[model samples]
Target: MTAAAVETKIPASAEWMRPGRVAVLLFAVLSLVAFLLPDGVLPAWTRQLPAEFRIGLDTWISAALKWLVEDATFGLFTFKDLTRGFAQLLNVPLDIATSILSTGLLDGRGSSAIQLAPPLPWIAVVGVVAALGYRFGGSKLALLAGGAFLYLAVFGQWASAMLTLSSIVVAAPLGIAVGLATGVAGYRVPLLRRIITPILDLMQTVPTFAYLIPILFLFGFGPVAAMIATMIYAAPPMVRVTMAALEGVPREIVEYGTMAGTTPRQMITKVMLPAARPQLLVGVNQVIMLSLNMVIIASMIGAGGLGFDVLTSLRRLDIGRGLEAGLAIVVLAIALDRLSQAYAAGARKRDAEGGLKPFLFGLAAFVAVTYLLALFVPPIATYPEALQISTAPFWTDAVKWINVNFFNVFDAVKTFILLNLLLPVKRFMMAQPWPLVAAMVGYAGWRLGGARLAALVVGLALFPVVTGQWDYTMMTVYLCGISVVVAALIGIPIGIYGGLSPRAWRVIEPAIDTLQTLPSFVYLIPAVMLFRVGDFTAMLAIVLYAVAPSVRYAAHGIRNVPTMLMEAGTSMGCTQKQSLRHIQVPVALPTILLGINQTVMLALSMLVITALVGTRDLGQQVYMALTKADTGKGLVAGLCVAAIAIIADRLIGAAAQKLAAQRSGAVDAT
Candidate 1:
C-alpha cells in the first residue's frame, strides 16, 4: 500500500479500537449471543451462586435484631424499654399537636384536668397563613397560602389535613435537628465524613419499607413507628445538604470570623450558619418535602391523617375521595415548598414601617376576633357541613368515563408495548450469563473510568448473586430499565421543546414541579385505576414517578447551553434543528445523564411501593418480609435494591464525567 493509504487505514483502525467503541462492540456481541441462546437462559451452573457459598446475612441480621430487642441490655435498660420510653416521650408532643389542630383541649376531657385552648378557627388559620405569606412573599403568595387552606376547609378535609400537618410540624424539626448535628460532625471530622458518606448513600437509596419492618418490631405499629421511619427516611438529604452548605462556605469568611475572635460555637452558629442560611433553608425544604412524601406510605403502618384517608380511598377504589385527598396533599406540598423557597431566597426585606410589631399585633387580633366569632358563628370555627363541596363525585365520574371510553385503546397499547418492547428487553437481560453480564458492566466502567471502577462495578453486579437473590434482582433490573427508557422517550422531547421556547417553558415548568412534588403514592392509585394491578400498572407508576427529573434536568441543561454557540450556528447558516442536533444536545449530554441517574434512583425507590400493586420483584420480597416481620429478609432485599442503585449511579456518574471531559477537549480544540 502507498504510505498515504497506510496512514489513512491506520487512523481508521485506531478510531474503531478506541476503548469506548470496543466496549460497546463487545457488549453488543455478547448480548446478541445471549438472546439467540435457547430458552433465553444462562447455563444452570452459571445462573446462581453455589448454595454453600451463599451468605445468610438476613438470618444473622434478624437474629441480631431479635437479641437487641429481647435480650440485649445496657445497665438497667433493655432495648425494648429504651424504645418504648422514647416512643412515649415523642408521643407527648405529637398528641399535643394533634389535639390542638383537631379537637382542641376545651372540647375534650384530659388526665391533667387543665383546660387548654380550642383548635384555631378555620377562618383564623386562613388569616394567619395569608399574613405570613404576605410578609414573606407578598400578595400572590398570600392568595396561594389562603386559598390552599380554604380549599382544605371547604372540601371538608380540614380535620384530616390538620392531622397530617401536625405530624409534619413535629417530624420536620426533628429531622432538621438530627440532620444538622450529624452534618456538622461530618463536616468537622474527615474520618466521620468518610464513614457517613457511604451510609448516607445507602440510607438514601434503600427503600423506605425496608427500615419500617425493624422500626415496627421495635416501636410497634403505630404513629410512633411511622414517625421514626419518616425521620430516618427524610433526614439523610438534610444532612447531605447541610454538609454541602457548610463545605461551600467561603474560606475568607471563616478566616474573618476566626480573626474577629469568635469562639468555635459562635463561628458556627453566628457566622458560618448565617452565611450558609440559603442552603440550610434549602435543606429544611427538602426535609419537609420528604416528610410529606412519607405521609401516605407511613400510613400503612398506622400513621393516621390525610395519608390514611388516601390509602383507605384507594383500597376501596374510591377514585373521587382519593383524588380529593391527593389534591390536598399536593396543595400542602406546594405551599410549604414555595414558602420555604421564598424564605431561603431572602424574599423578606424588613419594612421601614413598624417592622415586626404591627405584624404580630395583627396576627394576635385576628386570632382573638376569630375565636370570639367562632363562639357564635359555627362556620368560622369549623367549616360548615352544609356548605361543604365534595369533589369525590366528580372524580369518580371522570374515572368511570376514562374506563368506559379508553379501556380498549389503553389495553391495545399496553399489549403492544409489553409484547414487543418491554418483554424482549427483559428477556435479553435475563438471558445473559451472570459472568458475561458482570464483564460487560466492568468493561463499560473501565472504558469510562479505569480499573478501580471496573472492579467496583463487577463487585456491585455480583452482589445479588452472592446474597442468593439473583432472580429477584434481575426482575428489578427489568422493571427499572423499561421505566427509564419510557421516561426518557417521553420526557426528553418535552424538555427540548420547552427549552427552546420561553412561553412553553412558563407553562411546562409548573406542571413538572407539580408532578415532582406530588407524593409517590398518589401516582399508584391512578395507574391501578387505569390498568388494574399488575406488572404493567407497576411499571406505569414507576414511569410517572420517575419522569419529572428527566424533564427537569434535560430542560435545564439545554437552556443553560451557551447562547453564543447557537448564534454562531445561525451565522453559519445552520438551521435550528441542525444546531440542536449538532451542538445543544452534545453539550447537554452530561447533564442529561445526571437526570437519568436521578430517574434510576427514583424508580428503585418506587420499586417497593409498586410491589403493593402486585409484582414478584425484589420489592415484593421486601413487602413480604415486612408483613412477616422478617428483618433479615427485608434488609437483604433492600440492600440488593441499594446495590442496583449504586451500580447505576456509579456507571452513569463515570459516563457523565467522560462526556464532560470530551466536551472540554472539543472546546479546547475549537
Candidate 2:
C-alpha cells in the first residue's frame, strides 16, 4: 500500500489524545478516583493540602493590616491618626445632616442642655419632599413622596428613619462626587481606565462584610467608618455609568464641539457633560440605591438609624419591632427609588418659561412656615404620640399564631427541601475531590473560551484548597450553588410569563421592584422569624434576595426577541409552541444565560450574608474574622468568595458569547 493509504488506515493519530477528549477523560478518572477511594486512601497530601501550599496568607494579611493600623506612619502622623483625622472631617457634614434631619442642635444634656435649633419639623420635611417631588416629576410623585414621609412620622419611625436618611444624605453625595471625578478621568484616559476597571470589579465583587474590617481598623468603630464603607461600595456603579454615558455620546456632537473651537476642558464640562446629563442623573440614582443597601450592612459597625434599630431589635429577639424597622426601610427605599427615578428621567428637562422661580419661592415659603409653626406646635416638630400606632404586638402575635398553627407544615416543607435537595447536594459537594472539581471547571472554561480562561478558572478554583479553607469553600459553593439554581428555576418562568404578557408584567413588575428595593439585611428578618436559624433559613433568604436579577433579565431577553423573527417563524407555518421552542428560546438563550450569571453572583454575595443564620460557609468565616478583628481571615476568605464569583461570571459570560456566536452563524448560513 502507498504511504497515504497506510496513514489513512492507521487513522493518523489517536482520537483520545485530542485536548477536548483528554480533558473529559482526565475529569472522569479523577472524579472516580476521588469518589471510590476511602476517605483516608486518597493520601492526605491530595485532600488535606500541604502546609507549604497554605503559605499562611491569612497570617500575612493580618500582620500587614496590624502594621497599617498601629505602626505605619506618614510624615508626622501615624496611619491611625490620619484615618481618625479623616473620619473627623467626614463627621462634620454628617453632624450637620443629622442635626438638620433628626437631632436638634443641642448642647450638653438634662438641665444643662441648650437647644441651638430644632431639627426640621416632620411636617416641613414631608412638605419639602413633596414639593421637590412635584417640581421634579408631577403631582403623583408628590403624593408618593409625601405619603412615605408621613408614614414614617406617623408610624413612629421618625427619629430612627431620619437618622438613616441623614447617613444617605451624606454618603450619597460623597459617592456621586468621587465617582464622577474618577469616571471622568477614566473616560478621558484609556490607561487610567485599564488601571481602574479591575479595582472597581474587586470593589463590587468582594463581599460587603469584607469592607467593614479594614474600616474598623483604620477609623475605629462609629458612623464614620460605616459611611466611608457605604461610599466606597456605592461609587463603582456610578463610575461605570459615567464612562458608559460619555462613551455613548454622538460622534456628530463631538465634531460639533471641536469645530466650535471649544477647549478640551470646556468641551468636557460644557458640551459632553450637558449632553450626558440625563444619563449622569441615572448614575446619581444608582448611587443612592447602593448607599441605602450598604447603610444597612454598615449599621453593624456603629452607623445608627433604622438599620441599627432593626439590628438591636433582632439581637433582643424583638421580632415585631425589627420587622417594623425593616418595613420602614422598605418604605424609605421605595419612596427614594421612585423620586430618584423621576429625577433621573429628567421630567424638568423642558421647564416652562418663568416657572422655576415661582416654584422655588413657593417651596421655600412652605418650608419656612412649617418650621416657624413647629416652634409653637410641639406635635408639628415631633410626630404626635397620641396619633402614633404600634403594630408590634399585632405582628408578634401574628408570628406566634402562625408558628403555633403552621409549625408542622413549615417544618415539613423545610424538611423535604433539606432531605431531598439541599442535603444531598451538600454531601455531594463536600465529598468531591478538589482536584477533580478544578479540572471539571477548567474543562468548562476551555470549551467556552480557551486555554487562558481555563487556566484562570483552574487557578481560582484551587485557591481555597491552597489557603486552607477547602471545607468552608465547599459549604459556600454548596449553599450558593443550590440557592442560585432554585432562584433561577423560580424566577425565569415568571420572567418569561411577564415578558410574554403585558398584563402579567404590570402585576409582576411592582412585586419584583419591592423585592429588589428592600435591603439584603431585611430578607434575613423574615427568614429567621419563620425558619429560626439554620442553613434552610439562609437558603430561603438567599433565594429571595437573588431572584430579582434572574426575573428581570429573562423578561428583558424575551421581550426583546425580534418581532421580525417571530413573524418569520409564523410565516414558516410554525405553531406557537413550535416557534417558541425553535426560534424564541434559541435566540433568548444567551440572554437567559446572562440572567443566570447575574443570579449566581447575587447568590454568592447573599451566601456571605447567610453566615448570620449559622451555615458554616466562607461567610461564617468572614463574620467570625470580623468579630475577632482578624483582617487576614476575613480578606482571604472574602477573596475566595470573590474568586468563585469572578470565575462563575467569566465562564458563564464566555458561554453566553459562544452561544450567541453560534446563533449568529447559523442565521447567516440560513
Candidate 3:
C-alpha cells in the first residue's frame, strides 16, 4: 500500500478509541462506578437533584393559568367571559348539526309542538353516504359505507351514532379551516413553520386527558369544551399534512402560474392551492379521523354519544354492551376513513362527466324520496324498536364461554409475560440510578446525531428525575418498551409475508386498514375482557393500538425494494431466504426502523388511555389530575410523556438516517 493509504487507515485498537465510541464507553464506565459505589461516596446530587434545583414548571403553569382565568381581560369582559361568549357562538353550528342528524326540527307551541321534519331518515343518511362512496370509489366502497350506516340503524344505535356524527361535522371542518390557514401562512413565511413545528409537536404529543383538564376549567362542563378539544387535537396533523403537501407541489406548476401573469394572491388561490388540492384532501382525511378520535375521548367530558355508551359499558364491565358500542365506533370510523381516503385518491383520476355521477344522483334522489315518505310514516323516520336487532346476548355468552374453557391458557400467558418480561423490565429500569440512565441516553444521542442531540436528550431525560417522577416514568417506559418489542415480533413477520407475496398483501391490506381506522379506546375493550385491569391489560391495549404501523411500513419497505436488485440476487443464485436476509433486509432496514419509531410514539400516546385500565405510570398521574381538576399535575405529567416520545422518535430517526447513510456509502464504494 502507498504511504497515504497506510496513514489514512486506523488500526483496530485505535478504532475503539475514536471520540464518538470513547465518549459513550466512558459514560458507561463512570455510570457503573457511580451506581455501584457507596451511597455517600459520590456527591448526593449524583442520585437525585435537590428540591431547590427543580424547575417547578408545573407550579408556574398553574399560576399562569390561574391569572388568565381570574385577572386577564379583553376590553370590558374578563377572559372567562370572552371564552364563554366564543363558546356560545360555537354552539350554533353544533346545534344545527345536532338538530339535523339527531333530533327532528321542532316548531311553535308549548304543549303541542309539531315536527317540521323527522331527522333525516336513516335510509336517507345511508343512501347519501353510499352515493358519496360510489362517486369516489365505485361499487365496493358504496357497499361498505352503506352497509356500515345500515348496521347503525338496524343495531339500534342510530341516535347515539347520529350524536357522534354531529360533533364530527362541526369540529372537522373547523379543524380543517384552521389547519389549512395556518399551513398556508407557514408556507408563505418559512420562519412561521420553524416557530410552529415544536408547538405542534407538543400539542400533538400531550395526552388527550391533559387537554381536558384545562378545557374543563375554562369552558365548564359541556359539549363546547369537548368540541374545542376535538378541534385542537385534530388540527396539528392537518397543519403538518398541509405544509408538506404545499411544499411538495411541482415547481413547474408555479412557473406556469407566474407566466400566466398571476398576482401573489391569485397564484396562491388559483395555482398553488388548486395544484395542492389532492394532497390537501389527505390532510382533510387525517383531520376528520383525528376529530372523531378526540370526540370519542372527549365523551368523558360530556360530549355524549356512542362514546359515552361505550365508556359507561366499560365502567360497568358490561362486555356485551361495550362490544356493540365498540363495533359501532369501528364501523363508523371505517366508513368515514374509507370515504376520505377514496376521495383523496380519486382526485387524481377525476372525471367530472363520468357515468358514476349518474348513479350517485340516482341514489341521492332515492334518499330524498325516503325523507318525503318519512313525513307520512313515522316508522320510516326511525326504525321500529321491536324489529331492531342486537347480538349482546351472544357476545356475553361468548365471553363467558372463553373464560370458562380457556381461562388457564390466558392465565398462563399473562403470568409468563408479566413475570418474565414486563415486571422484570420495570424492576431493572427503576433500579437504574437516574444519572446513569441520563448518561446512557446522552451517549446514545451523541453516537446517533452528535452533540446537539446528546444535549437535547439529556435535558429531556433528566426532567422526570428532577421532578421526582422517575418511578412512574420508568413504569411507562417498561410497559411501552415491552409492547413495542412484542408488536415488532408479531407484526414484522406478517409484514414480511405480505411484502414477499402479492396474494398475501391483498388480504393484509384491508385488515391493517381496519385496524388503523379503529379508535384507540376500542382496543381497550377486548384487552379488559381478556386480562382484566392491570399492567398486562394496558400492554395489550398499547400493543394492539400500535402494531398496525409496523406491519404497514415493513410491508411498504419490502415491496419498494428495487426490481433490478432482486433480479441480481436471483442471478447470483441466492435462495429466497438468503436474498431477504442479505439484500432486501439491509435495504429495508431504515424504513423498518421508521416503523419501530412510529410504534414507540403510538405506544406512548396510548399510555394515558391505558391508565384507565389501572396501570400506575405517568399516564395514571395525568388521569388522577383530570379527576381532581389539577391542571399542574396533568400538564407536567403530560409534558413528561411528550418528552419521552420526542426523545425516542429523534433517537430512532437519527439512527435510521445513520444506517441509510452507511448503506449509501457501501453502495458507492462497491
Q: Write the per-residue lDDT of candidate 1 for residues 235-327, one digit (tens) a residue.
A: 999899889999999999999999999998899989898889778889999999999999998998988888999889878988789888988
C-alpha lDDT values of all predictions: 0.85, 0.85, 0.84
Candidate 3 per-residue lDDT, tens place, 411-484, comes to 89999988988876776665567777887888788877889999999999998877867778888888989999
Q: Evaluate model 1: give its TM-score.
A: 0.94
Tally clashing residue pairs in candidate 1.
0
lDDT of 1 at 163: 85
lDDT-based ranking: 1, 2, 3
Clashing pairs in 3: none
How far off is residue 47 in model 3, in Å?
4.5
Task: Kindly give the stretch of ten consecutive residues in candidate 2 with the minimal lDDT sum.
Answer: 7-16
Q: Please, what are the lDDT tens digits per residue for candidate 2 over residues 1-670?
A: 2322222221111221354786678777766656666787766766658887786899998899899987899879998899899999999999899889988897875588788999999999999899878877789999999999999988999999999999999999999999999999999999999999978878888898887898899898988899999999999989999999999999999999999999989999988988898889899999998888776688999998998888787677677898788889988988898888887786446353347788889988988898999999998889898999888899889888898999999999999988998887887777787877887898888777789999999999988988998888988989999889989999999998898889999999999988887777778876787888898999999999899988988899888876766665666676777665666666777888899998888888787778878889999999888888889999999989988898999988987887777666545533
Which runs in model 2 stand beyond 4 Å of their true positions?
1-33, 108-113, 351-354, 666-670
